[model samples]
Target: MSLFQVQGLVKRFGGLLATDHVDLSVAHGEIHALIGPNGAGKTTLVHQISGLLAPDAGRVLLDGDDITALPMHRRVAKGLSRCFQVTRIFPAQTVRDNLLLAVQAHSGSSFRFLQPRSQAHGLYEAADRLAERVGLQGCMDGIAGALPHGAQRTLDVALALACAPKLLLLDEPMAGMGPEESQQMVQLIDSLRQDMAVLLIEHDMEAVFRLADRISVLVYGRVLTAGTPHEIRSNAEVQAVYLGTETLEATP
Candidate 1:
C-alpha cells in the first residue's frame, strides 16, 4: 500500500469548488512533485492533507489507516508535517531557541513560562542536529529574524523536521529565492529523501524536474497527468496546457 493516499478528496468554499475530487498517492520514500499554474488548488489540497482544512468529502489514508477525521495536532503525532511557502518562525527568538521550542513541542513537554533553559538540553541537542542537517549550524545563536532570507527559509524546513515525520509536505520551498538560494534549497531537499517521503508543490520547473521521482500535473482543480519526467515531457495534454507546443517539440 502507498504510504500516503488521498482518494476522491473534495473541498468547497460556498459555491466555489476549490478541489474537485482529487486522488493522489505517494509511495514510500518517493519524491513526488505536484505542479500547476497559480490558483490550481495545490495549496488547498495541501491544507486538507495537513489538517488545516478538512475535506468536504472522501478519505485520507496514511499507512493504510484512515486519518480523514484526525485533528491537526493528532495528524502531526501520526508522523505528517508540512512547511509553508511563507516562512513561519518566531522572529524575536534566537535560532537555537526557536528550534528548541519546536523540539519541546514535538516531545510533548509542557509550555510553561518559567521553565529553565537547562531543562531543554536534550531538545536543544536534537535541534542542533536538525540545524546541522539543514546547514543552519553557523547561525544557531543569531536571532531568527536577522538571518539572511535563504537561511530563514532553511530554518522553516528544519522546524518542520522536528517531529521526525514520515510524510513531509513542502509548499514552494524555493518560492522567492535567487538562483543561488534555489540551488541550495534543492540540495537540502535532495538530501532529505533518503529517509522520508516528500510531496512537493513548486513552480520552478527546473527544480521540479530535477528532484521529482514522479510528477503530477494539476489544472483547474483536476489532475491532467501523472508520469515520470520523460513521459510528462512528451504528454500532449500537459504540453498543451502548460508547456507550450514549441517547447514540447524541442524536447528530443
Candidate 2:
C-alpha cells in the first residue's frame, strides 16, 4: 500500500473550488512530484495535506491511518512532516541552536536546567547529526539568517527530518536557488528517498524530472495526469499546458 494517500480531496473558498476531487498517493520511499502552472490548486492541495486547511471532503491517509481531520502538529506526530515554501528556521539563532530546538521538540526531551545530562547529550548529538546530514556541519556556529538562501532551505529540511517522518512534504525547495544550489538541493532530496517518501510540489521542471520516481500534473484543482518522467515529457498535452518550448534539462 502507498505510505500516503489523498483520496478524492475537495476544498472550496466560498465561491471558488480551490481543490477539486484531487486524488494522489506516495508509496514508501518514493519521490512523487506534483507540478502545474500558477493557480493550479497545488498549494491549496498541499495546505490541506499539511493540515493548514481542512478539506471540505475526502480523506487523507498516512500509513493506513485517517488524518484528514488531524491538525498540523498531530499529523507531524503521526510521521508526516512538511517543509514550507518559505524557509521556516530560527534566523537569529546559530545553526546548532536551531537544530537543537527541532530535535528537542520531537525527541521528547527538554533542555531544562534539571534535565538529565545523558538525555541532553543525546539531543546535542542528534543536532550535530542533522547538521551533517544536510551539509551544514561547518556552519553550526553561524547565525541561521546570515547563511545563504540554499543553506537556510537545507536547515528547514533538516528540521522536518527531526520528526523521523514516514513521509516528507517539500514545497518548492529549490525556489530562488541558483544552478549550483538547485543541483545541491536535488541531490539532497534524492538521497532522502532511502529513508522516507517525499511529496514534492515544485515549479522547477528539470528538478522534477530528475528526482521524481513518478510525476503527477495538476491543473485547475485536479490531476491532469500521472506518469514517469519519459511519459510526462512525451505527453503532448503536458507539453502544451506547462513545459511549452522550455527545455527540461537541469539548469547549468
Candidate 3:
C-alpha cells in the first residue's frame, strides 16, 4: 500500500478552483517532487496535506488511514512534519536552545520556565544528535539569527527531524540559496530519504531532477503529469504545458 494517498482532492476559493480533483500517491522511502510554475497550486496542495487548509472534496490517507479531518497538531503527533520555505527559527535563542524547544514540543511536554537547561538532558542529547546529522553541530552555541544562510537552512531541517515524522513535507527548501548552499541542501535531503517519505515542493528544476525518484507536474491547479525524470524530460504534453517548445528543443 502507498504510504500516502490523495484522492480526487479539490479546493476552492470563491470562483477559483485552487486544486482540481488531484490524485497523488507516494510510496514509502520515496522522494516525490511537486514542480510547477508560479500559481500552480503547489503551495495550496502543501497547505492541504499539512492541515493548514481543508479540502473541499476527496480524502487524504496516511498509511491507509483517512486523515482528511485531522487538525495540524494532530497530524504532527501522528508523525507528519513540515518545513516552510522561509526560515522559521527562534531568532533570540541559541541554536541549541531552539532545538531543545523543538525536542520538548515533540516529546509532548509543556514548557517549564524555571527548569535549568541541564535538567533537560535527554531532550538536549537528542537535539544535539539531530543537529550533527544536519551539519549544525559546530554552530550549536551561536545565536540562531547570526548563522550563515546555509547553516540556518540546515537548522530548519533539524527542527523537522526533531519531530520524528514518518512523512516530511518540505516547501521550497532550496529557495534563495547560493549554488554551494543548494548543493548542501540537496545532499541533506538525499541523506534523509532512507528513513522517511518526502513530499518536496521546489522551483529549482536541477535539484528536483537530481533528487526526485518521481516528479509530478502541476499546472493551473491541476496535475498535468507524473513520471520518472527521463519520462518527464521527454513528455510532449508536459513540455508543451510548462517547458515550452523552445526549452524542450534545448533538452538533450
lDDT of each: 0.89, 0.92, 0.89
lDDT (tens digit, per residue) of candidate 2 on 1-252: 999999999999999998899999999999999999999999999999999999999999999999988999999999999999989999999999899899999987755847665748888899999989989999999999999999999999999999999999999999999989999999999999999999999988889888999999999999999998888887889888887756543331
Q: Model 1: per-residue lDDT, tens digit, 69-150? A: 9998899999999999899999999999898889889988877748676986677689889899999998899999998898
Model 3, which residues run further than 4 Å from truth? 244-252
Candidate 3: residue 115 lDDT (0-100):
84
Candidate 3: tens digits of C-alpha lDDT, residues 1-252 = 899999999999999999999999999999999988889999999899999999999999998789999999999888789999899999889999899889989987669957876777788789889888898888899999998888888898888989988899999999889989999999999989888999999877778878999999999999999999778878998887786655545422
Q: C-alpha displacement of 140 in model 3, angstroms?
A: 0.3
Name the top TM-score candidate. 2
Error of 2 at 233 (Å): 0.6
